[model samples]
Target: MQNNEELKLALLIASIAMLMMAFFVISFVMYYQKKRFEEEKKISDIEKNYNRLLLDTALNSEETERRRIAQDLHDDIGTMLSLTKLSLNQLSKMIGTTGDEKEDQIMKKSQSLVEETILHVRRITRDLVPTTLERFGLLEAIEEFIDKLEEDNNLVISFQANTEEFPRQGQKLELTLYRIMQELVNNAIKHASCSRIEISLESTEEMIGLRVTDNGVGFDPEKIKENNLAGLGLLGIESRLAIVNGTVQYEKPLNGGSSAFAQIPVMPIAENKPEPLHPFRRERVNI
Candidate 1:
């Protein structure tokens, strides 16, 4: 009888010990899995930050190069063209219609060509750096751009802002927004076969929003994403918006058109801050 009792106790103790060992093994596995997951997440976050830094650097470098090129065009080629135009005017005066109709016509055409070229250079410089964006705020700059686009093309573009008085966001954010707008507009023009576009800009306490709606053949944003079929224009817009910590969404309106909406967080403007300078008000001219 004593032997039987001892055997039962031993069996119970052994079973308990087995259970304890199993618990320990399960706990270890779970702990190990959690640590592995944490390590992978950390690595992923580090890689993402590194890539963002690289992208930011590349974009900054590109902007620097743009500024350099714009300055060169404006100061050098622009000056030379102006001088050439002046020289032509002086030559025309000196030759004074000595009954040489052909010579006079040639001089007039040469002057016209030089004037057109000068305007072209100015346009290029403006596009490269967007001096209007620097001097005026984002709204005015975008309006100026739209005006130019309307003057050149038959497509009608309508712009609306929440207010006439828009507070100045920082230069970097404004420029990024402007570039994104340009990309969206260009994409619509190039691919959408749209006749009319509606653009809206709104500013609130926490965020700035831009929406562009076009009456054209719409696209499936999800399909584009799944197939990795986004063109360079879409990719460029995404990259620019990402730099500014902004987001963009593309959707097809029920009315059978496409719309792109972008939003960026911004701090509330200080009332005491001075207004932006609109030194040279951009005049709408036929390009």
Candidate 2:
């Protein structure tokens, strides 16, 4: 009887030990799974934050563009149209006068005003979205833009490129890159006070790169990093670049100027690419 009691006691102890081992294994697995889930959640949160930033930047950019267009219409074309209307009213008053040289001159002046107003409207429309960019491609469009700026005789711009046979990378990429370049040029003209500017484009097997250098007062990239919202132009560039999986670097060159370099990695193009963005097609959502 004593031997049997000892045997039963030993069996009970072994069973209890096995159960405890199983419990420990389960606890370990649960702990590991919890850690993995937390890591995934962290990554998800980071992505969401980045996407929100992009959306906000885009909205701000759209608002800025709308204000610029409105100002152009009100200050430029609107004023001219008003003056032309006044000229027309005067011309109407003297229409019945006989062989008056002054009346003839007024009519001619009115015609000239109408023509000038039409030209101004066309120029504003072109700036909103260049037809050359839509049809001839990015390089030609940039060349034409530079040529127009040259006509103003305010600054000298030089363009160098290896883009004669550049492949179509879809409209989003093209438009984003073009806008970045345009913003950089505007900054140089408005802030840099640079006399000479250089723009270059190069392509490789997997990427396209653009560099813009100016001989002007250089900027501190650190300031942009610290306060991105300080300059809408820079913020807009970064957000647009993020959308296309591109990157930009800004530096104050040792030779006394500012330089910006951008690289856009190429992805496999779909057989059916989306249509290029058109000025009229874009919605101007007001904030």
Candidate 3:
């Protein structure tokens, strides 16, 4: 009877041990499940946010393009039509041309107007189709952009390509970079009020860096953020660089002025130019 009691007690203890073990296993499973649930939730949130940002960027890009097209049309075609109308009006006013007096004078004025309009139209069309970018490559295209800036703004610009060549990359990325540079330089002229602009492009085996500097009234980045939100020029640039897997950083010089630096990881190349591709059909730029 005593031995039976002892066995009963042993069995009870064993059962209790097993029950505790089972409880622990259940706890562990519940903990694991909860962790997995949290991880998946976080991932979902990230994906949703990413999609939202992409949509916003696309819409903004479209709006910007529409504005640019409007500009080209207004600057080029509108100018031509206005001059043509003026010419015709001048001719109409000079009615009753005796021999070659008024007719010659009116014709001369009209010819001059027509010539100016043609030149304007051709210029706008060429900007729409800068075949040089494909035929000449990035360096040459940059030089041309600089020359055009000088002519339009009367601003002195200096540029240097330290790598001697640009690497093979997605066309969109290249175009984005070109536009970024253009935007940066344009902003300096319009707002910075700087007399000189310096540009440098350097590359390493795994990365390329671009720096544009101007000795102008440098503003604090933190201050700018507090003052404005959407209208910030560099904000759009930051978004644009992200689309190309690149970065843009702002630097306030120790002495004076400001510098904008951008970098992208890329394999280095030494060719004088990239392989020719189809011409860059100028998308009507956003204003």
Candidate 4:
């Protein structure tokens, strides 16, 4: 009886020791996994910040170059063309039609060509750098752009804002939004084959939203992802929105067509603070 009792006690002690060992091993594994996960997340966050910095630098450089080119076109090429036109006018006046029909026609044609070239240069300059956007604000700039488009194309484009007196967001936010709008409109016109487009801009205390709806052939998001049918336009839109910490979504309206809505979180600018020169330099809000 004594031997049996001693054997039972030994077995129980051994079992308890094995359980304690198993518990320690599991605890160590779990702790190591948690630490490893935390390290990976830290590394990932660092990489994202680095990439964002690079993107901001690249975009800022591009905008600066664009502004430079626009200025040159306006100051140099545009001025030179105007002067040539003036000179032609003087030459025509001095000659006063010497009964040379061919020469008269040639002079008239030369003046017309110069005027046309000047108009083209002005249009290109406006496209490269939207002066109206800088001077007036986003709403006015967009209205002017849409009006011009309507005049030039057979399509009907309508724009509506939440208010007549839309408040100004900073220059960077405004420009980024303007560019995104331009891209959306261009894409709709080129790809959607829509006769009419409706664009609405809404601003609230927390966020600013833009919605573009068109009655045309819509697209499949999955197919676009698989086949890359979106081309660079979609990518450009994404990048611009990313810079502003905004998001865009596409939906197929039940009536037949597609709509794109983009939202950017708004941060109220301090009344006394000056707007930053670079739009990308503004504080970002994670969506």
Highest-scoring model, lDDT:
1
lDDT of 3 by residue, 146-227 (tens): 8887888767899998766665444444555666787788778877899889988887777768889999887676666677
lDDT of each: 0.84, 0.77, 0.69, 0.83
User: Which is superior by lDDT, 2 or 4?
Assistant: 4
Kindly list the per-residue Cα lDDT of model 4 for residues 139-219, writing each as its tens digit.
999999998899889999999999889898876678778988999999999999999999999999888999999998988
Comparing candidate 1 with candidate 2, which one achieves the higher TM-score?
1
The worst-scoring run of ten residues by lDDT in candidate 3 lies at: 278-287
lDDT of 4: 0.83
Each candidate structure's count of clashing pairs: 0, 0, 3, 0
Write the number of the candidate with greater lDDT, choosing between 1 and 4.
Answer: 1
TM-score for each of the candidates: 0.85, 0.72, 0.67, 0.86
Better of 2 and 3 by lDDT: 2
Worst 10 residues of 2 by lDDT: 278-287
Tens-digit per-residue lDDT, 54-129, candidate 2: 6757755764485467556656776778777777767756673766777777777777877677667766767766
Every model's Cα RMSD, please? 5.4, 5.6, 6.2, 4.5
The clash number for model 3 is 3
lDDT of 3 at 162: 76
